[model samples]
Target chain A: MSEKVLMKGNEALAEAAIRCGCTHFFGYPITPQTELSEYMAKQMPKRGGLYLQAESEIAAINMVLGAASAGVRVMTSSSSPGISLKCEGISYLIGSDLPCVIVNMQRGGPGLGGIQPAQSDYFQATRALGHGDGHAIVLAPATVQEVVNTTTLAFDLADIYRTPVMILGDGALGQMMEPIDFAEVPRRQCPAKDWACTGTGMKRPHNIVNSLYIQPEDLERLVEERFERYAKIEAEEALWEEQNTEDTELVLVAYGITARIAKSAMNMAREKGLKVGLVRPITLWPFPKKPLDKLSATAKRFLCVELSMGQMVEDVRLVVNGRAPVDFFGRTGGMLMTPAELLAQIEERMGK
Target chain B: MSADLSFLHSPRITLITGHYGTGKTNVAVNLALALRLSLSPIALADLDIVNPYFRSADARQALESAGVEVILPAYANTNVDVPSLPARVASVFDRPDLHAVLDVGGDDAGATALGQYASRLEECGYRMLAVINARRPEIARPEDAVAMLRAIEQASHLKVTGLINNTHLCEETTPQTVESSFQYADQCARLSGVPLVLTTAEERIAAQLQRPDLLPIRLYTKNYLERF
Candidate 1:
């Protein structure tokens, strides 16, 4: 039987990491998510686990890379600015095809932005992390329980794909307490770690996990192999949550905290005699493209609401392919469009 | 800002700010009530869009019963008539209503929305005060706190008039911390050229944390003050 306790998204994430057998966690502290580190700070030490609060995000994420190379489940976390610092490390992690977890309890940021909830990092997390031809499996979780659920999935997906994964969130979700059930993953679900360094011995002579490419041919082959793996990952793993999409006329595409708010707004829109629905992407990178393709056929229009101005809307338009009208409403720099505000957008979009 | 105006003007607008777990919202609510007793018309607008727990709105019904104006965004999608800004609230800011307090979300990004009311606030002569709880955020270091204040000021497009020192750990808060809070207030006053407006009192826990220089405090407990 599963026992549940009210936990913040961050705390739930910590529990998930433990259940995933992540014995090493390296991170620096940042706002809207100090609780995760605080919890880890207490629990990791007691469990004979390693929790190192590195000097900076760069150092912390690099530590994650080192631990993951040795085939131990590892993670690092930060809010926006700190995540910006982690970008260099993340690019390297992806380049090397190392498996690790990066939890960004997102706060507002262009530079040193406020510690309020924001979906602005969508663009940063998805694209433009270092100047690299690389991609991370980004998981956008909406609730506290999903925090644990997605985190466990992050570790699983990381090992399977040999890639880094990120769980994106905002301050509200990070700090708010909610009911959470703590359940152990089935032992059979644990990752098989054959390809890892694991201190290879005399039989293999030596094991190497390096992003370096001294020879041009080797580099080209490595890049092609990485892309091929990405292709397979994309084919197998893409998650989206659908609501009333079967015959829905209007669709609101959102994720993370905005998805929860959109869910509430969709409920209100229904009450106001409007047939509005939501399409929330759980996997931000392998961004559940099938639903977008399917919804484009039936849903007359789509509105992409985000904390950033129109970044995700761009993605929606791409998937939409002019099948229907696409609109946007957003609040950047730590702003949240209230339920009323979202409902207003829904009404206006419906031309009511 | 004039030195006297900063120090002596009625601190009509009490702006509460702090990290997530601090009692900033409760202090703001209690202070608003204290102001209601002293000043006729009072209002509390919860701008805590970022952090959802322990909001000033939790005490809205009690304050409303005491005839205090509470300005909140409209729940228009509820499909029923729910006032956005209550009549008393709209009226308070409209004319010579005495108290006007804003409970902004944590910091500047939350305060950024205050820019929309710059003209009206300037007309009504609202005072902005950044409340600090030194222990939380773990970086409630004076310099860091000052930076947060400057950011809040820039976002609101208004100068903060006074400093409110509300340093307390959860239930671990004590009178010693309250006394030390005065020192924090003094630093803020010197740095921003504002006065230490008020101190808080949890009547039950007062014996453990009493001080001579401290002002009468106002605190909130759900069971005690069923009606504000």
Candidate 2:
């Protein structure tokens, strides 16, 4: 049996990153996500790793870029607002094809929104994390244990694709606690950082890490190549979990903390003989379109529940594509929809 | 209830304070619930102004439904980040019959909020207990634990009457871990001149130890938001 330990979601992420051999963490203090930085501040120094409380979120992310350029596993964490500040740096990392992890312990958004669990950054995280053509591999974990497992995978995915991978969590997942077994997490084989900008020492040509191109043709070609890589990632890495979808009339689509609440609603709807199921997207960027499309073949309808104002519902709608009706139920501005409220919505929609 | 917790005699007011991540709120919740086993008119006051997570006020519904009056700040369970102490905190002293348990904030900065009620707490002859988790990085050493206790005392303006050894590594905690922390706890107790009033372990570990001073408690810090 694996060693089981109870830990807060944020703290667990820090520990998992350490176990995954991440030696550098740079972040600024922000609500809900502060514990992640706090845990790093306490543990990183003890482990002889670099933990810097950067001047700002922008500085922290740039620091991550520098560390990643040096051929070492590195990460940076922030909340929604802080992530917004790090947008340019994120795009730079993407353009340079640097491997690093970024954690967004999401809080309420749209210019200094309150400190509460929110998924308002869905559009920002999945569709447009930064300006210009860029897409990060976004992994949304539903539990603390998943946070641990996915964090390790996020590092591997980042390295595998030479791109920044995001662990998009919210205040609830950051604050919540759960028992996790980290004993047997299989490490993936990543390509060596042969292109890293370590000192040349006259043995090899100097490697440059930059996101700038003087020629439009060169930039266009680079963009096309990056999209090709993204296409492969989309085809291979899209992940989701299905519950009771094998025989169900309605499939509930949600992610992160909302998925946990939706699970309770699904169970209640099942007890009421309502044939309800849930398809929780683990990788939000890939959007789990294949599984949802599969469920659309048999399910009568789909309901996308989220902490935002129906951001992910757009993805569900695109995938379902008139084969089945897609509806959205969401609560924004840091308001959480209760299980009872969700079940009532499910019944009302199904009854109609 | 375990035999070890029998020594708990309800005082007019009990204050629980400790370093951050030391399981003070957990201890406060367990103590309030255990005291409710015999004491009447129990009130658990959430005085935490430091940490946004794991505040006693978040468990208001459960505690109140169980007939314990819960006193919280104006923004106790809300997403508001302001640290405004409620006027109802003074009401706990008004009701002398109420066995009030104050779950203060973590560390000296958090404990500083308790300074406003220092005179009231002192006059009421309260028993302030410093919950110690040797696993916490800030107070992992005996000297660090002593320094934290003194800082909490200086900030709260209330002396710690006893030490509640609550050392554990969360879900990874084992009986051996609890047993090993005894020395650290003893060092803190001896240096601070505070009695080791209680030692807490999870129910399973507590059952294995059978120590007279151990208080077996169910974990309550996690899932605090799910209850709401």
Candidate 3:
């Protein structure tokens, strides 16, 4: 048996990326996620990979774009504000049909919000990360081990879809310590990068990696094709976990660190004779609507808890679509909601 | 619940140092809380500037209520991620009567903050304890553990006088996990020439280990998903 090693979520994510053939890392330092860059800085050279600290987040993401266009597994990470700086490059990567991984250890904010953990970037990650009809595969893992698993799978998914993949972590998940086994990482077969911009030695035609389509009809055709891929991803890649939802009336919906807290709250409600369950979305972009759609028929109510002022609740409400009443309970501006506090929300929603 | 803390002997100042994610804050918090039972006016100075979360500031309410004075950075647990140190951290050196427990940051990056107080710590006579958790991949080997210990010493300009085996897999720790780490810790002590002072575990797991110097401690730091 492979020995389990304890690691912080950020460092574990970095190591997982390296283990899964991420040969290049371009990053800038930001709180709650700097350790990922720090780990890459220390270990990348030893593994014969490149780790460059770019001048800024913009420089780092464009560096990622450059590396990914050459058919190498590359990644960059940042906190909430830094991710905002990388959006234009991310859109370029999407428009050029490049594959890479971008990690956002989310902090509270519209602008320079607190460094403590917050999931306020749900809209940023799942909705308008880049200014176009484009969506990165946003994965939200609650535990450090899950952070590893998702990071390892992220590169593969990006390659499979030829799109940028975002590992949406929070400050708490980035800083917390947990045991993870690197030997247990699952590897998927990625499709060949035949359209890479690698120089041809007069053997094949030159490949052009550009996002600038001047003609409106040409841009529309490419975007429509990308949407077809997005449709396939939404149909096949929506991931979620259901706890006690088999016969529960009150179901709590959360993602990232908030989901972990809601799990504890659901257990406390269960012990007090209230039927409570939890729906945790592991993939935030795909949004895991199928299970919620199925549970909306039986569950009486759904409470969306987050570290933001009800961002993910909008998605939950839209998914439930009045099949059941969806309620919002949250704490914003870097404040964390404890299980006891969430239990009170559950009990109040259950009219107890 | 106390597992005979007689084997533990902290000087006027005890600085805890180790790699990141190796439970430095956990050990420092547990030691300060346990020592407060008999020692008077114990203060836990959070000198970690590297990590933003899971610092001693997170356990300030518990330690303060237990009569342990908690001194941390002003920006700790706040929205800002500034790496500035507080002026009150010097109170540990000013008050000679106070038994201060210093929780240094993880690895050499965090230890740079502790280097600022090296002169005062040397004059006052301090014992720096390096924590080792064998389950951590970076320091799983004895040589890597010793190298990390030496790196912490180089960064902080203070020598590690003792070693504490605080190895565990968080909530998944078992007697076998604690037992298996014994050789790793012992080898680290032998290589670094530092005495292996104490092996910490929960009271239940402490009862199972056959060691003379075991300090059974309750965990004060919590993972959000642990309750599940």
Candidate 1 residue spans exceeding 4 A from truth: A184-191, B1-228
lDDT of 3 by residue, A1-352 (tens): 2888888899999999998999999999999899999999999999999999999999999999999999999999999999999999999999999999999998989899889889999998899888988999999998888898899889999999999999999988998888888878788889999999889989999999999999999999999999999999999988898899999898899988888899888888889999999899999989899889999999999999999998889999988999999999999888898899898888887889
DockQ scores for all predicted structures: 0.03, 0.30, 0.67
Q: After superposition, how far is residue B183 of candidate 1 from its true place, in Å?
A: 42
TM-score (chain B) for candidate 2 is 0.93
lDDT of 1 by residue, B1-228 (tens): 101222322645556654344455776676666666656677777766544334566687878988777776543112122223333434545666456667766667567756766777787777676677665432356776777778878887878766666666434455665666667667766776666765555654455554543334444433110000
Residues A158-271, model 1: lDDT tens digits = 888889998988877887555455564433254577768876566775667788889989988888999999898788889888887776889999898888778888888888
Give the alpha carbon lDDT tens digit for every residue of B1-228 in model 2: 464444455457899998877888888988888888887888899999877756886667768888888888777656668888889999988888878889999888789999999998877778889999766655778998999899999998889999999888776688987898899899999999998999998898888886778789877653412211
Name the better of 1 and 3 by lDDT. Answer: 3
**How accurate locally, in lDDT, is each candidate?**
0.73, 0.87, 0.90
- The pairs that clash in candidate 2 are A6-B171
Backbone clashes in model 1, listed as residue pairs: B175-B209, B200-B217, B201-B217
In candidate 2, what are the lDDT values of residues A1-352, reduced to their tens digit? 2535556789889999998999999999998898899889978999989999999999999999999999899999999999999999999999999999999998887899878889999999998878899899999999887898899999999999999999999998998766576885767889989999889999999999989999999999999999999999999999998889889899999999999899888888888889999899999987788888888899999999999988999999999999999999999877789898999999999993
Top model number, lDDT: 3
The residue ranges of model 2 lying beyond 4 angstroms of the native Cα positions read: B2-11, B19-23, B33-42, B61-69, B87-99, B107-109, B115-124, B132-159, B163-196, B199-228
N/CA/C clash count, model 3: 0
User: What is the TM-score of candidate 3?
Assistant: 0.96
